[model samples]
Target: MKKLSSLGLLFLLILFLSGVSQIAFAAENPQYGGTLHLSNDADWDTLDPAYASGFDAGEMAVKFYDGLVRFDFSSNKIVADLAESWEVKNNNQNFIFHLRKGVKFHNGVEFTAQDVKYTFERLYDPEVASPGTWVYPMIKGTAAKLAGESAELAGVKVIDDYTIEFDLSEPFGLFLTHLTLPYGLIVNQSAVEKYGADFSQHPVGTGPFKFVEWEHDNKLVMKANQDYWAGRPYVDQVIYRVIPQPLTDIAEFEANNLDRTVVPEEERERWLNDPEWSDYITTIADLSTYYLALNSDFEPLDNPQVREAINYAIDSKTITDSLFPYYVAANDAIPEGMPGGSDLPIKADPEKAKQLLTEAGYPDGFELDIWVSDSSTSVRVGGVLQALLGRVGIQVNLIKNDWSVFYNTVKNGNAPAYYLSWWADYADPYNFLNALYTTDRIPFNNQEINSLLKEMTITTDTDQRIRLSQQIIKLADQVGDPYIYLYHTSTSYVKHPWVKGDLYHQMYTADKLLTWWIDQDLKAESTN
Candidate 1:
């Protein structure tokens, strides 16, 4: 009896281990290699990670690029990609990264610590005009170089072929986290040399996937990097079909020509109601804020009180209903669940907002042009913002244009006071308020806000510093420099019934694809 009981326990242990092993996809197994088709409503603006600015471009690059550090969206934690392991100096002024051994770029060039050092230095080089330059200011002379005012960035040093040490001039607890920024993604030096201005058009990286080809608006393809340090991807290829219009995306998915497409917001439920399609639909709360950016240097927006008043002018509840129904939640400038000061509060007060505008000398309100992209949803967002301001007596002359022109105008910081857009980068409150508002940081910044942000950078204790950070967050709520606190996005990616497993939409879906697979019955339909 004792022998029989011991044998039973052993068998149960083996069963448990087998289940765990299958879940992690450990040990040897046949690779389920195949191609996947994904479509998005917007086309990628550029493929260069260093210069990729919007979600439209950045998400497309994630299929083929790997950053030194990347965020695990499901866990909201930084995990290694290019670097194997790392440690932060006690003063928060240094981080040493140990690169994985025997890894090579898609172009077959050996990667070294020098590549890491050069990447940051090049980004800080004003001639490159890399938008990621804002992240290197803690490297002492980085700011000057980024502005074309100086020559060298003083922080990066290669200790050896496999190791690199980064010395920050100031401490930032979120520094490692910021390393997950799109601008910090790894690129092939060989490809850049070979492709030149065409590098973006034909890129290469050390990610789990390798770029195959991009046929413009038709399709973009990538194949599995079997030698990937993270292990082989389940699907061998990811083919992105560029479907610019939301309606077109819907029609293609329904017609079965496309395997998957970004589900049109209005048709999510329609798919959900269809049993054949409902099982294929998946939702990931877009940890993104789609809102308007006020050009602080513009006429009416130059007044801080007027900005504060505009914050109270919008009725967000109405916009969320009209635009996305109950699919969104009210959002402050900063995304939810991020570390923040205890003092911050979300705002809404039409009466007080109008009074503040009157005090700012716009008693009869002001006439202004609000700019938006040509996308249908973008137009809807702009129109609602126009109506919200109208309620507060500000007559908004809505100006619509293509996304490329809209982004360029806003980035120049010479926008006509109102421009609508969103941030999908960075997962902290500082990103929304401090990074965007402060001077010497980003495209739209103010010197006064910049002064306060410098202080937040120096405070090391997590809690104490969060207090200083909170002050700015509260200020954002009060003034609404670039936002009136609209709703955060909740979107669905509805696919065909055969589509079983897929990545979620935390804006970093590509990183979590190992867990996804096509249904057994539908596997035959997937094209390689």
Candidate 2:
């Protein structure tokens, strides 16, 4: 009897120990070593930090590049990345950055202040012709370099191997934020010289991930930089698969092939309601604006009255509620939740629209072509607008083109009107105003608005800057009539249950991939 009791006790003890072990395993902190499977709708245009402008390329660049400053997604503050610290001197005209030591590029070259100088100089180099050149206009001597007056930027000076200085032409409040952009990402001078124009295909930088292979139109693979300054990333590798079809992406996510993908509009509700998928669906309010960009150079649209009529003809509420339930109807150019943003009353006024059309000498209606990318959402939106504009005696011919071709066409001012969205490169009102309204990217040009935008850049006072921003937005609306502010999008992504870490950011879409981890056991269970 004693032996039997001892044996039973031992069995119970073993069971308890096993249960404790299971609990411990479940509660343990994330373990590193799994590939994160991600998908994008399109292929990257370029990997070169200075010239990469599209979102797809920018996301990939984040993995392999480090900027002087970085925007912390959780805190929403500008924090040090390559530059450990910085100081604003000379009345905000001079910025002195103390670089972090022991950092190395993917190619094993030591990062120094000279690389920072080289990066900025290359941006100002007329030979490179980066569209991002507009980002560095405040850097002193940039104008001279662009005009062939100088070879080097006078403002960018290397104080030492670990310190660099930037002398601005004026006190630009958003200069630090600007440095956080992808354009400000530092590149190894030797690497650029080695690859030359082919550097876009083979990028090397001092980021958390190192470039491994880029199979164009298929996948761009990256491996973890074990010697990263911030500690190696949790994931072993990141595979960005190019899957253009939205439904196909969702299907792959369902099949456990893709760890992260955007939820298609048709399947969003189904996924939101499913108990299995409910926890994986994340909706993020994006700091972006979708609009119909009107070219003032295009006849009829050149008339402000006709633009106002087009804006009034479309029903924003219908579009937002029916087509894009995740989006918020926009009334003004500046999105809500930002400084200087307004929720002005903007509704479809057919009577006022008709009056404006008559005033613009289109009383009998007219035909116009509106260009859009071949994305399903863009096509649907265009179709809706076509129906609405037809009621107002305006025929809207929807012209769909491939993403790359459409972007190039619009950028070249070949499209009289285009459907597009402007995402914030940084969390600032200046980025929105300057990029959309002030740049030559849009045909609408107003001298007074331009002068106010210039003032907004230099204005430091929060209240004053807000006031100036609002004034600029109002002026653009009145004169330029550049865009019919449609709605603010809510970006939704479906993450597999095993994927851990925050993924949503106001300014950057891919920064979270650096810290994200995969639970091997859970991932295996899901797959099995």
lDDT score of residue 262 within candidate 1: 72
Could you give candidate 2's per-residue lDDT for residues 359-410 as a string of tens digits?
A: 8899978998999999888999999888888989999899999999999999
Question: What's the distance in Å from true for residue 219, model 2?
Answer: 2.0
Where does candidate 2 stray beyond 4 Å? Answer: 1-28, 147-149, 297-303, 358-363, 366-369, 373-375, 397-416, 441-443, 477-480, 509-512
- What is candidate 2's CA lDDT for residue 336? 45
Candidate 1: tens digits of C-alpha lDDT, residues 439-471: 321244545556667666655566665666666
Candidate 1 residue-wise lDDT at 139: 71
- Highest lDDT model number: 2
Against the reference, the lDDT scores of all candidates come to: 0.67, 0.81
Q: Model 2 shows how many backbone clashes?
A: 0
Error of 2 at 321 (Å): 2.7
Q: Candidate 1: list runs displaced more than 4 Å.
A: 1-31, 42-45, 125-127, 140-153, 292-309, 327-331, 336-375, 385-394, 399-416, 439-452, 455-469, 478-482, 497-501, 509-512, 522-528
Worst 10 residues of 1 by lDDT: 1-10
